[model samples]
Target: MFKTDHRLMGEKEANNSRKNVQMQEINKRPRINLPALRDFLSQFPGKFQRHLKSRFKRPTETEGANRDIFKLKDANFSLEKQMQAWKKNPVWDDDQPPSIEVVVPEGSLCQVNVKTKVGLPPDAVYNIVTDPDNRRVFKNIKEVLSRKVLLDEGSRQIVELEQAAIWRFLWWSGTISVHVLVDQNREDYSMKFKQVKAGFMKRFEGSWRVEPILLDEKLCHPFKPKTLSEYMSCTQCNGRIASKVTLQQLVEPAIVPPPPISWYLRGITARTVEVLINDLVEEAARIKGVSATDLVTTNLNLDQALSNEIQTLDIKERWALRRRNSRVKERKDRF
Candidate 1:
């Protein structure tokens, strides 16, 4: 009995030792770095606050006057008259590409303006621009990381989105993450967007405007039925309506590249604007049973364009581009 009791005590000691060892092993496992994560998250609120301050900051008297002048210019602009003027002047060709202008206001604040024509109604153009799933149409955009509706009432909506894009520098490339707050005014067919948070941008803001142009009656040809077998035509025609689309953006990269390179990146930005406008125009034309080739004098194939641009880059840039593309593809496949 004594020997058996001693044996039982020994087994108990061994069991306790093993349990303690197991506990130690569990404690040794890696844990989530909560403090580090919290530190990173703490930065977001400050950034967001600064963005709000900038957005709501009142403009100076001179600035306000300049804004009014711009508004008046836009209001007075007539696409039909411009087209007629171009037709009359040999120097102003009908096949001229869209005009893109850039301005630098204050430090790092870059404003870009793009003017183009689309063969569609304002309503259709507005719908395309305000569509929540814009990534489905715009190929350059890698992903719409997240979209949250903050306000949804009749003609106005406030939305927040997280989007990602891959951009290339001279011999390096990187993915840019942007968090944006968008205020949409459907009544005026305008969308205003500003970046609240970004990984590589200090600020990004933009506006889209779509206006309808009414064609003159003289330019319209009345359809008449001559034979009894011919179908009767309506006497009154409102004539074909064309849409004028304007896109404006202000971007300030977090890390601005050196000269020449910076200019090249700006050029890329302009090209991106062109591509987006062209895509919208093409889609609108398709809805109206018109082919893109008919409306756009110069059609750009985004995939091919991107490929050619990548080829122009040096070896390092090409490698970076490949890596980013792979990562983007993997993310897409995962989703």
Candidate 2:
């Protein structure tokens, strides 16, 4: 009887231990609230669609109306005449200098207009601007990562480009990746660009116009005798050309800042326009066989000053160094 009771007690203890182990295993497993989880998952798709819709919405009616003002109906005829006049004569006022105008017509929508003169022929200037491979000339551009021709026919070509650009605002500075579609019209000497995807921009589009100024002798009755003589007897009378370039851009940032920050950004935009025009002028001079020293001094004091300011901003050093390093790496790889 004693042996049987002892065996029964041992059995009872073993069963209790097994029950405890089972309870502990159950405790270790995570208890999920399935209904709450299902509700969250069900809501995710709708929220994601709404978010995407907001970011990628088409341009508003107001923006479309503003853009309509810049559209050209008969581009070929008008551009041809403009080109002929420029090739025939040069017309420029010594008093009028390059200028940039910025207008904010609506919320976060900014328009910038740049008017500048270059000593190169309109055709040369146009060629430089339209060449996708030549984007390294622009100060803000770090690199032209890739360029793919989508459509190419006689005087018109559509290209897609990927570029890296450095953007600086006071103490803030970073690089931006940009994907753009460029429609180039060689006949019109015009190029239009729109950003398809970019890191920091919501929408960016721009147009470039290269106009040659050929003044009719009959229209210069009001100028002084000396001025008239200089204008008429200038070296640019026969294909020695001067080009008037107009750049118009509309841009909106991905995220809008406060009023003070917005003002600061606008100032940066204006300065950027100045730098770009100066770079173009320098490029034109270079094409005409002008020396770098002459290019720097000839009415380019503002450009020099701006260059100095940019250097102080610490943005140029980064990109310049990066480009140098990349060149070195490429050379090494080839070897």
Candidate 3:
């Protein structure tokens, strides 16, 4: 998840003055001899550059030692380990409609959750999603104009270069360039991406998540197993492990359009995600030699949908209900 910038204000003038004085004193110290250092490094010709390049290729961190934590990798929530303190909930049906919702309750930016069940191992699914060569699999991505590796750690790309992907919106019959910085991690099977130098959108960021799930109905309801390995190794389950993938994307445009155009914009975004999930599911089917699995997701706004059945209400009661709903949404989307 990504959030906007926030500025910290100093409450004490004394502290501000003290910080200014400290900064002034530090600036009085002699500056480093950058020209001399550059000259010395230049004398080594390509050796320094080669060493620098190789350094980036070395293993940067131990597995599971990353400071940045992924929420999807949380130990509980039926995805990983189990604790008696946590409540259990059943997974959604496989034939439901697309799963997309507003991440923030009041902001211009919106987040979409697209998920589906794939008849493949987690590693196999992970490889397909992270591989740029398979960009053609995503129908929305017309072409990956350019992709470069900015930094690599061992075999994984820690900080990747900007990848310019041309996306065509079928509704508008036009194309837009999406420039993104990808952070691919093989350790947790997650890929974090953020848009760079925005064009169509002012802000765009999200991640890809892959988790193993059992396909059996008896064992899936309430998800009896505590871990993926346990579910996959069950005797009655037949040693099958299907991957449950989730793609979360947050987008914000430079300017808000009127309701007429806004509806089309939302349609374009949701349609793109639909294509992405369908393509991934189809690919999984082809690889595993099985039928395409239907999406196993649920609507996020069921409560609101149910409330629409109310036949009548007072004007004051309606506004009060509106305020209650707004507060609930804000709480859900709060960072």
Candidate 4:
């Protein structure tokens, strides 16, 4: 019994010694010190957001505009200047057709440049194009299936929408659904759009820029605009501002067809642009002719409910995290 007790005491002492040695070795090891990095997202929130947004819009191929189109102000965002966006627009004459040119920027991709000078104000043309409910005016667009405002700044909005567009080839006709993300800015009188997912189009993106063009450019003393407006003031024109509107769109298909089909596709794209521009021109003329009260109360041959209709899926967290159905109200058509 004495021998066993003595051995147990010795084992305990051995374990204690081993533990003490391990503790000493651990204490002797050098520690790593990492420098503290500043969190710009938290510290400089505005700057960080601007940095992120800058990555979204790359400069257009041509050297048009300040590209500072995204610079927005809540109170002082003047539509008069629009940051020199229209300065380099092609001199579009009233009698000529809108300049439409197609360029293949990359493999099987077509980028279309459409520029036209409208007789109406930039704001008038801009309002017609930016309104989602105005699809009725566009001949090719059948309907907007769903529209969601992802981000809404006072002068700017980021919208995600699905559109059903009527398409025809030879004797056959069909409706194509397109999903796109649109960045609409009233400050710059511009809208930038890109396809969210690839379907009929492998890649699709575009920008619409509406800038003021004076009726008389020769009225100014110097090239510098004397007044607050971008277009120089004129006695003959009575501050009558026209719009130099430009649309640059790039569209590439999931599969490129042979010669005849490709040519047909190009024709379709051009005609679609023509329809859009024609719509804007006509709508502006109609508005300019009508009284303010008539303009406000006019039905515009449109469905009253379209402006308020929205349908979208709920956040994945509704089912994934809680294992319960979402509380969101869903339309029967969704099923």
Please give the range of 10 consecutive residues that has the lowest summed lDDT in model 1: 63-72
How much lDDT does each candidate structure score?
0.65, 0.66, 0.58, 0.64
Per-residue error for 58 in candidate 3, Å, reads 35
Flag clash pairs in model 2: none
Better of 2 and 4 by TM-score: 4
lDDT of 3 at 324: 95
- Inter-residue clash pairs, candidate 1: none
Candidate 3 segments whose C-alpha is farther than 4 A from its true place: 1-98, 103-109, 159-171, 216-237, 291-335
Which of 2 and 3 is the better model by TM-score? 2
The lDDT, on a scale of 0 to 1, for candidate 2 is 0.66
Error of 3 at 36 (Å): 38
Q: What tens-digit string does per-residue lDDT give for candidate 4 at 124-174?
A: 678778888988677778899999999998889999989998876555789
The estimated TM-scores of all candidates read 0.56, 0.55, 0.53, 0.57
Q: What is the lDDT for 62 in model 1? A: 28
Task: Give the candidate number with the greatest TM-score.
Answer: 4
lDDT of 3 at 84: 13
How do the residues 1-335 of candidate 2 rate in per-residue lDDT, one tens digit apiece? 44568888999999999999999999999999999999999999999999888766553432112111122223342434434444443333334658889999676647899987776546678877886656667777888888999999978999998888778866668878878999988766789999987557888889998754433432333531122124334423332335578899887987877644566567677777777776786676565555545544555556546654765554445556778999999999999
